[model samples]
Target: MSVEAWTTVLVILSFIVYIYIGWRSRVSDTKGFFVAEQGVPAVANGAATAADWMSAASFISMAGLISFLGYDGSIYLIGWTGGYVLLALLLAPYLRKFGKYTVPDFVGDRYYSNVARSVAVVAAIFVSMTYVAGQMRGVGIVFSRFLQVDVSTGVVIGMVIVAFFAILGGMKGITWTQVAQYCVLIVAYLIPAFAISMLLTGIFVPQLGFTFGDIVEKLNAVQVDLGFAEYSQPFANKSMLDVLFITIALMVGTAGLPHVIVRFYTVPNVRAARYSAGWALLFIAILYTTAPAIASFARYNLIDSLHNKTVAEVQQLDWATKWENTGLLQFEDKNGDGRFQLTPEEASNEIIVDRDIIVLANPEVAQLAPWVVALVAAGGLAAALSTASGLLLVISSSIAHDVYYRMVNPHASEAKRLMVGRVMVGFAIAIAGYFGINPPGFVAQVVAFAFGLAAASFFPVIILGIFDKRTNKEGAIAGMITGLAFTIFYIVGVKFAGMPTWFFNVSAEGIGTVGMILNFVVTLVVSRLTPPPPADIQALVEELRDPTHHVPIALTDIGEEQLD
Candidate 1:
């Protein structure tokens, strides 16, 4: 069969496997839908968490970004992984111990205010949507290339597939399906890297290939010869503070992400949550550490193929012609020298290398087999779909459980709530599809914005709620609002409105770090000025702190339905 045919077959089989798993694991109750009945084992939950964390950004676009950005891309590595540590040590165990269905459940009950809950729900929905939109776009990109369809059609297909698994099985279906996805994606990602590694350095391991052979030195030599900076040097031309702040922002944002943090709630107990985090990091590190090797390999191959070659010669290369059709790679001889120059000024053709194409095109670029290329298509979809389903669940559950059931229809039955959650999943997918069809920016940039928003809005209040008993409703609400407003304004002004610069020259991606400080300061001052939380709520916080204490009923059960 042809490459496209093989790709289609592999992709179809993957969807079938996921749909089957989801069908078998279907849930009927609100608890099952939202938290998978809290029965997931630590190891499985860890795998699911890894799937949830390694989204399209990590799988498809990250290597591309690293390929181009070189040292600057290290921020994504450090920031995202570091955030998992923060989550394990500071947030996950406590939140899991608190045992609410959603993040808003904690915020509302802790503050003893519906208004506080509403704020958290809004924040959750907003952050999840932002994150999911990027995932949907990722789905579209992968499907479009493999299925030979328009991006919009690919997005619609993605929506239907996600709705099938997400609405059908809820958390139970998604979690197990994610385990399968993790296996598919990790294997798919590693194979191409390993293939390229052996070709270049005769090394079996891509991670070891980086330092084991002459590949790194050759890659850097080629890059410098091409008039670009050395690929191995850290802090090449970028500002140190900018890199530092972006890393910090991403770390906090990773911890603050509702969808990722929600995974811990699916595990059985606080111990599972902690252990799951460790396993998650181990799984993620496999890809996280290997990505740089792939990036360097891809960069080396790309430059080697094009440099000192004529336009006609380049056009003859199958990979070059294939990518040029997508408009992601182009060639023009401006000086009519007939040869492609690596330097920017002399190079006639504008090589608008869309950062996303790096990973998806890596197999073709490295001249790998058709099967490896097909596997990449499947892997990309798995990465995007798994993350999308998880985020959609978070958005839907927050709306149904936190907003509608908790506030509007407190008398709603468990069955009714479960149905509402499923419907909301479909609704959320539609909205995410709209954004996918019409992305505001690149997938990574848009996702980074979501991270910043999450960092600014939820991180401060959540940490304080756990660690500071004196923080009252007024303080939490004020902090969330202040943090969200500043972060949003800075992002909008800089990204959309053409604001020249922000405080400390921090980019929009890192501005959340500044917003976090504002949130902390406002929350501290306001908490001191306001009355402390009621005695009962304060005692509840105290109990949550004591790891030995038996978890209260509120933490373990679906909250009692309140009357209107």
Candidate 2:
């Protein structure tokens, strides 16, 4: 089959499989919709968790970012993956033991305040929306290429498919479908990487080939010849502070994300939660390790194809000509010279390459089979669709369970709540589709904001709620307010006002590191000043500290007893 035909077949096959899983696993009750009735096995949940966590950012953007950034990209690999360690050890099992449906449930009951739960809900909504927008945008990008349609049309198509699964099946449906997505995406990602690896170095392993091949050395020599720095050099273009704090923000932020944390809630028990985290990390590490290898291979091939070639000659190259039509790769005869030379000087090269296109374009750059290119298109969509479905569930559950049932109508029936949750899923997906049509920025940039916000608003408060028994409602509320408000202010200031100077030279992406520290300080100071939480709430904390015991009933009842 032709490339277009193969792309159509692969994408349709993956979608049919996912839709079938969603239909088979559809949930009727609130418990099943919200947390899969806590019946998922550890290994299955782990695979689902890996799919949920590896959004378009990991699947499509990480390799592209690394292709351009060189060793500085290690911050993303380390920061993104390291946070799973924190989640597995510090938070996942304990939260699972708490036996609540949502993160807000823990916050509200732990602090013995509805106001705190409401705050967490708002934060969850914000974090999930920000994250989902990027996922939808990624979906649109892949679909635009796969279906040969416009991005806006692709986004609409993607939104409809997501709504079908997320609105009907909820978490149970999403979980099983995501397990299938993990298989599709991971296999799709690995094949092209292994093919490119073998082609470049006569080795099947991309990671080993990346380090062992003479290709990198040759690329480095080309960089020197072109007056640009070596591609393998550390911190080639970024500041040390940018790398340091961004890594920290992303690491802690991963632990704070609502969708990812909620994955732990699907496991059968506290022990399963812990085991699931380990398995999830192991699965994620497979792609995380291979991404750099693909990045290196693509980077080398891209530079090799362009260096010493004239603009006219470059226009004739199949990969360059193909991507140029998409506006992701552009060339101009600046300085009136036809030759292309990628030097440090802006005018040295005639090409302007969009970093986002690296992975999608990698197969073509390597002159791989057309079918491999089609598979890559399908893989990118799987990554985006899986994560988008998970985030949509988080957004809907926060509104239906946390806001409606928990806060507004405590007497609401499970059926009514499930309907409301489904409605909210449809509503949220529409909003995300809107953003995808008119994206605020690239997929990775929007995701960075999501991480920064989650790190600032949730990470410190959740840690304190678990570890600090004396941490009261007032302190937790004050901390979230400070963190959320200040982080948004910093992001707005840097992005809109062009505020050039930041505290300690931290970039906008790394400002969450600072926001987290301030949250901890404000929380501590406020907790010391306020009266301690009631005896019952304090006792509940003690109960949560031991993960060996599972609390099947609602924690809200425990909080209400103190009030009564």
Candidate 3:
């Protein structure tokens, strides 16, 4: 069968499974909708967590970034892995033991102020919307190529699919569907790697034998011959300081992400949460370690295929023309030589390829089987939809649970809350779809913005709330506002407003590290100046942070006594 036929069959089958899981796992009550009733097994929850975190960013954009950026792209791998560890060791157990339904819920109860909760809720929605835009864009890219549709139509299709499960089953449905998604995405990711590894280097092990000894040397030589720097050369495009800052931004951003943090709350207890986190790290590694190998293979293949080829010659290649239709891959013969040539200079470079398309197009570039190409299309959608669903849930939950029920109408019914949550999902999907069609940047860059925002707004407050008993509502509220506002100003001014990189030549993506530092300083200074939190809240923090407190923290007891 043709690639589209295979993709339609596989994608439809995957969607059917996801829809069925959504139906089977549907929840009416707020608890199940918000946190899966806190009953998920560690292993299942771990897989779901892995799927939730490894969005289109990891699946579609990470390898694409690495393929183009070469050595500089390793920053994403380092930052994301380090960030997960930070959350696993420092935040997960404590947050799970606190027994909250959402991050805003924790902020509200911990700080003893609805204002603090409200701030966290807004930040959650902002960050989620920004991140969801990337997922929706990924969906657009995959469908535009495989299904032969425009990017806008593809985004609408994705929005509808995500809304179905997210509105009906909530977290309960999303969790189970994500487990299945993890399986599909991982299989889809690995099979191509195995095939391409064997084809390129005659070795099936990508990580161990990825152009292992001499293949890299050959690839590097090809790069140099084309007037491009060696593929492994460090700081080819960005400065060292920028790399450090971007890495730190991504790391703390991962720790502060609301969707990922809520995964721990779905597990039964602190121990289960801890176990799930470790398992998730393992699952994430399987994809991550393979990424560089894929990047290397993709870069080499790309250079070999198009370096000195004419547009007409390249168009004869089915994959090249198909991707060209998506408008992401373009060429211009500036010198009228009738051939596209690769070069380091922007003025003479004939090809303008969107880095986002590299991974999705990798199979076709390598002439893998039709089924493999179609399977990759399905995997891209799976990765995009999985994270998109999780993010939509976070957005709805923050508004419905955090703001409406907790703050606006403390007496709302469970049914009413669920309805509001579903309604909010519709609104969020519409907004996310719009951004997908008109994204500010490519998939990975947009996601990096979201991460930086999360690092700036949520990381410091959550850290202080957990470890410091003296942290008060005034401090948290002030810190969040300061950090978030500053970060947004810098990102918008630089990215959109053409504001120069003023702070030590740090780009917008890396400015989040500075925002995080400001948040920490402002929080500490404000906390010392203001009165401390109430004695009960202080006791709760101390208890959760205790070295020997492995069991649950008995948050219900504290809630009964002082929180209400």
lDDT of each: 0.87, 0.86, 0.92
Model 3: lDDT to the true structure: 0.92
Error of 1 at 69 (Å): 0.9
Q: Give TM per candidate.
A: 0.96, 0.96, 0.98
lDDT of 2 by residue, 311-427 (tens): 678878765776676666777767776686666677565678877778888988898898999989888988999999999999998999988997799899888999999999999
- Model 1 stretches with alpha carbons more than 4 Å out: 344-349, 550-564
What TM-score number comes out for model 1?
A: 0.96
How much is the lDDT of residue 547 in candidate 3? 69
The per-residue C-alpha lDDT of model 1 at residue 118 equals 89
- Candidate 3 lDDT score at position 299: 86
Alpha-carbon runs more than 4 Å astray in model 3: 547-564
List, residue by residue over 1-564, the lDDT tens digit for candidate 1: 656888998999999999999999999998889999999999999999999999999998888888888888888888888998898789998898888878888888877778889888988988899889889988888877777676798899999999999999999999999999999999999999999999998998999898788987887787787677888788774578878888888899998999998898898888888899999989999999999899888888877787778878887887677667655576766677878766644345435567787898889878888889989989999999999999999999999999999889979999999999998998999999999988877788778888888888889989999889999989989998999889889988998899966587788888888888889999999999988877777787888899677563363232333211
Best TM-score goes to which candidate? 3
**Per-candidate clashes, comma-separated:** 1, 0, 0
Writing each residue's lDDT as its tens digit, candidate 3 over 495-541 gives: 99989999999988899999999999999999999988888889889
lDDT winner between 1 and 2, please give it.
Answer: 1
TM-score for candidate 2: 0.96
